[model samples]
Target: MTDDKTLGVYDEKAGDYARLMDHDTIAPTALNKFLSALPERGTVLDLGCGPGSWARYMVKAGFRVDAIDASAGMVEKASAIEGLNVWQADFSDIQDVAKYDGIWANFSLLHARRAEMPAHLARLKTALRSDGRLHLGLKEGTGEARDSLGRFYTYYTVAEIRDLLARIGLSVSDLRTGADKGLDGTVAAWFTLTAHG
Candidate 1:
């Protein structure tokens, strides 16, 4: 079942979320860096793709991009973007089986409850093509809950995230933590992993 609290937080903050992300400009650099390491012309899934910025970048890069987000408002915004296959679905509800060459989950999975992460990771694994890569960016910390903005978040320490990934059969290719100049300039932990299933 969907987490009402989490959805409520995003629903309430949808408009501000767009303004804060400024996806069109800020996403390309990271997208390019992630895409640079992938095979050309392969399918990609942009998990929690708000406003489709990363998906747009992927499409422009000549890769097919399928994207999803829990917020109807966000999905509508993303669908309006040209050349994107945007769906209003939660990551936990995704059912694609071994269909993507890359999964770019930029700043999305952190909203999931810690206990639910394994199943979500398993689903992601099932959705990837052989030798496919998965890149995820999450705020670094321990435990989970709502923030002052009423936006739900689940933070992870690097070691906790790495251990969880390994348990789900994903090999950690890269892991780093630092203050991201986004999300209101909060000191956040970020991770990038290339996993094969």
Candidate 2:
């Protein structure tokens, strides 16, 4: 993401964010399901991996994990996890082709601008091997806005997201939606979709 305010907030509150999304509470059901869909020991990319919670879990599960986040503070925290290869990078920096067996983009692409999502998703699709899986999490709604914490968000309804993914050549296989309290202390509706490239 290029938004300075959003990156700054995550930079300053990296620890708080990490603690809030603690290991066990970071959507284990969806995570484990995604893992089960992947080939054993398959390479994975934790795109926009904040605090590396998911990445760390995948590493422990024996996946080769490459994690990246835009916030330096987030990178610092994630880098500390043994066996995780992490770095500071924006969504636009993703350029690999047919390299990963799965891509975990939970709650991260929402930080991107609305106009940039298609290109970003395309890059992710291109980076995946045939039948590679992609797990995406996004706030469910329409349009874009800033959160209480000054972080930018681009929301999409289920249909909108499904169509977008289809246009990008990702076939949706599973979807789940719910409301949850985030680090900003307010409840928001969100959705997760599992797709294959």
Candidate 3:
């Protein structure tokens, strides 16, 4: 699937997708080891913050939260919610400079085209404060494909993720791979990595 098509898919279904993802209450346990390392009350940026649920969680936790999503409809929905600084923008267009203390990409970066990832990683590194925490998640697999919903996705093994992060001067602090329960009773092999800039 192309980027345009994927963004349009999201824009068209922002409300449905937001409701579908509203169940994220606590941080997923797979992310606990990484979350434990963050300094208290620090600023966090949520990239591709689909429904802003995670951002809302961070807000309740007392951290300042900024959210960005490529889907304008998603942004509209997210911005209406209290306690979120939401922006409508693509990942590659971000220009924040040494601003966030932590960055959460979740499953969002999987939509990135492979060749575009390195540059985006570099941009993310530049956007962070020194040694800022980065939590990223991607599916464990071999190639790009569209999902049943016709959204674009790219898969990567843990090694590929590590190499890309290392190339941009980030080092993994903790990494894990396994099946995770998803919405709609689905299970998927996911790689969760916490890295530092």
Best by lDDT: 2
The TM-score measured for candidate 2 stands at: 0.98
TM-score of each: 0.87, 0.98, 0.89
Residues 28-117 of candidate 2 have per-residue lDDT tens digits of: 889999999999999999999999999999999999999999999999999999999999999999999999999999999999998999
* Candidate 2 residue pairs that clash: none
lDDT of each: 0.76, 0.93, 0.80
Residue 104, model 2, lDDT: 97
Candidate number of the best TM-score: 2
Cα lDDT tens digits, model 1, 1-197, are 26776676666666777777764353555577678877898899999987776687689889989999988877877888788898888887778888988899878888887888888988998898767888888877777766655567888877777787788777776554456555444545555445554
Cα lDDT of model 1 overall?
0.76
Clashing pairs in 3: none
Off by over 4 Å in 3: 24-27, 30-33, 180-187
Give the lDDT of residue 102 in candidate 3: 87
Native-structure RMSD, model 2: 1.0
Q: How many residue pairs clash in each candidate?
A: 2, 0, 0
